[model samples]
Target chain A: MAGETVTLSSLVTWLSRFRDLVTENRNYLTELDSAIGDADHGANMARGMAAVMEKVGASPATTADELFKSVGMTLVTSVGGASGPLYGTFFLRFGMTAGAVSEFDGAALSAALRAGLGGVVARGKPELGDKTMFDAMSPALEAFDASVASGGSPAAAAAAAYDAAVVGRDATTPLVARKGRASYLGERSAGHLDPGATSTAFLFQALAESLAQG
Target chain B: MKKLINSPDHVLADALVGVELAHPELKVDHTNRIIYRGEPTKPGKVALISGGGSGHEPLHGGFVGFGMLDAACAGEVFTSPTPDQMQEATKVADSGAGVLHIVKNYTGDVMNFEMAAEMAEAETGVRVESVVTNDDVAVEDSTWTAGRRGVGVTVLLEKIVGAAAEEGRDLAAVASLARTVNAQGRSMGMALTSCTVPSAGKPTFELPDDMMEMGVGIHGEPGRHRVPLAPAADIAQQLVEPILHDLDFSGAPTIVMLNGMGGTPLIELYLMYGEVAKILQKSGIQVARSLVGNYITSLDMAGCSVTVLRADDELLRLWDAPVNTAGLRWGV
Candidate 1:
């Protein structure tokens, strides 16, 4: 967290905060999913994050690649829904992009997050208006990279990402979904907050909070 | 919410134990959450594996036996099984003739199976072929979204394809037959009420007392739209017409199933079947074989679905073939 570089500890702390955020909002996420999905989003997120944390806790990972690889694989194996593979691939890609490094400066973080988002897009085949996690995460990464390019500190970049993600999540309310289970609703999908987008917002919020400590 | 279980979180795990105790004919792999026939896949027989969320009893799991699936993975209620579970089943079920994964067309199920197919092949050198069944006519736009939710036709496909696999068809033939069964079937479902997932502990959606949700997916997802509750005959018309319209069922031997959603009684299901049968008769669709009752269901959703598979002699033969399984028992 010193200077602009996020140490391995900070990344783990970020993951821990993300886990806590998902666990706390599990019911809320499920409620959102119930409106448009299977009503398991909350339960799925809670269980998946809990599984990720368990893997993280057991024989703690010393490097970014080792950390998020387990995080991704754990989620992919423990969580059965679309979120499992999508989020799992995100972390797996992030870890792969991060290589064996223990610290990520602002630019490096942007590249890592960008790669994670690319993985999600590749896995889900989602478009911007698809009312998926991509809707939130895509914009958040853009804001993160934009702030970083403007010479913003890591904390400021993360804050920008979090703010953009919230805006992106809220913008989904009026959208008619074109993908996922919600898309099965067609017209009825409009006016409902996408559960995936909501969770993705939480992911960014956790990032911003972790970086705020710096 | 008032489900018979030790706890919400342990519903799947606890139910696996019950599945083991109740069915000695099948073997339950508790750690992997798979249900297999008492014996391993017969050597050289192409194994057929299918699974999905647990609430739909006798489906994937109960169908595992001599002439049906070799193994079935069980996910938490209303959730697709993980890839690792599917991979485990794939590895165990393979006997050098390869394995066929009969996946329901849900996004989660498709993705998980896709991953399992790749992983199983990569890790164990087991060849895996998959057939994703999307027989529900409910989701009108197949080119878009996740397409139709796989429903009752899955039962029909499992029986038909499983028989073919048991007959020692290669993976290519078994997988192709599975696809043919999927293409030839169409289904429509309606729900009188929304079912609650044990962990969610509440109705997934609310339907007014006088209204009914039509075209419902198996998970209690909101269907095409809600309509006023009607008589059994009218409800049958609503369910059967769309299926008939979606495909040409006339002049073909069709397998019809009037499947109940979990909560409806046998008496009501038979009554609904009567109405459904009448419509098919009037429409000139010959029913070569018929199955009624809760073959596939949403837990506690007081409703029914009708699956019509336009079949030929081959499918009918497989359908009639001796099969021994917990959910289905006949010629065997």
Candidate 2:
């Protein structure tokens, strides 16, 4: 989903699917957060997504870009915590980069996703291996780009991105945090995969799953 | 789970209802989950807004009034408020002068505030400036990380900066003062027991009867370390030493707040404050002003936090200025 479709409908569907995955894993995410964060990442994201679905349910966006922008605004206001803005910025920039395109070639989608990743980096100021969502997202985007360059379809590229996200998420367990609340734990922050990165992996997985449905 | 409540889901909303009913001076925007002063933003005056999770009561909400915040957005217990809520608060609180956002240094709080500022700027053309409070000395400040947690200094910063805004200061002045207040303050907290959020239906963390967690933040997240329970004097040293070590508090007249982390009795807090004061006196630190009680709190965590703000003459003046609000009311 990250590098697959630049259209507004595809983006909306992607966000809707992301919302579902977050809601389902809310408790699991919260459990991980209890180890390193305030124990609200799961609940916060669940509630934020619930709001997103509710807000977008009745009047679905006619365009993929509109849908992404709408979801971005909802997350910014509904998510409340750091995830809201970081994730919201991701989609806001994605929507802006993709503009009003109704559909996109693989290259267009790849560029939009890269642009979104750039937004997350700019806002979170996280570098590689900081045990942030960036850890998962950066690798996933790279995989998507590589897959598309190798002539994979949107669905196959999404699956590749999802695989990269999972690996990145798992990799966070051994890394020390240099950002967010977990960073406060210092060396003690090791031994726990970041709840943010884990949940972000779900975002890519959901995208792949949803695109398969389409 | 045995706590009194209609349902776990209704805790925050029901409590907010209770707040609006009990405090007529405060207005509740249940739709956006914001609690604010009922009065309109004063014309030509900069507006101040602060918010975080709900369990820390009288905070963003209690601090909203004449000499403090014009709006306080409330999120679920111990969760940061959403950006949209902040954006709405900014719009309503803005009086054509500008809006000052006082945010805690939590990742969620910082990001949400940033998004809200961006939204307000794009949609309403409201000039918004924010001061991030990171005065807690428990976490080491380094090149890599969000730095220290923002704790008790938040309460003091709001009051002092709120005064600056009340004086018809511009947004930049208000924001600058807020930042100065944050830089000059340091806080350290400890918890005897982990508090339970109503939704969670259990304590946030476990604590043995013989031990206490030191360097606790307002959230019930575990502290720097857990140590055996000590006497009031020893506990006072344990809390104050980190603060003293983190920053220089000597030679300046300081305002000290010995705050209870909810569920602690005033009797205990006053006793703790006595020990803290004696220790400060021995360390040659002058206490120009002090407040003892639950100013900022973790939900039902039986513990206390210490905050020392190195106040200048101007800050002292603002500290004593008239403030009419539900939480802090002074010279009318």
Q: In order, what lDDT does every prediction score?
A: 0.90, 0.85
Residue lDDT tens for model 1, A46-116:
99999988889986988889998999899888888788888988999999999898888998898889889
Give native contacts recovered, as a fraction, per prediction. 0.58, 0.62
Residue pairs whose backbone atoms clash in candidate 2: A8-A63, A8-A64, A8-A65, A9-A64, A77-B84, A80-B82, A81-B108, A82-B108
In model 1, the runs with Cα more than 4 Å from the true position are none
Residues B1-332, candidate 2: write the lDDT tens digits: 56667986778889888989989988999998887888898899999999998888768788888898899999887878888899999999898999999899988888888888998999999999999999988887555767788889999999998888888989888889898999999998899998876655667678899999887788887787889999989999998998898889888899999999989999999999999999999999999989999889887889999999998789999998888877778987
Worst 10 residues of 1 chain B by lDDT: B140-149
User: Model 1, range B68-87, lDDT digits (tens) per residue?
Assistant: 99999998888888999999
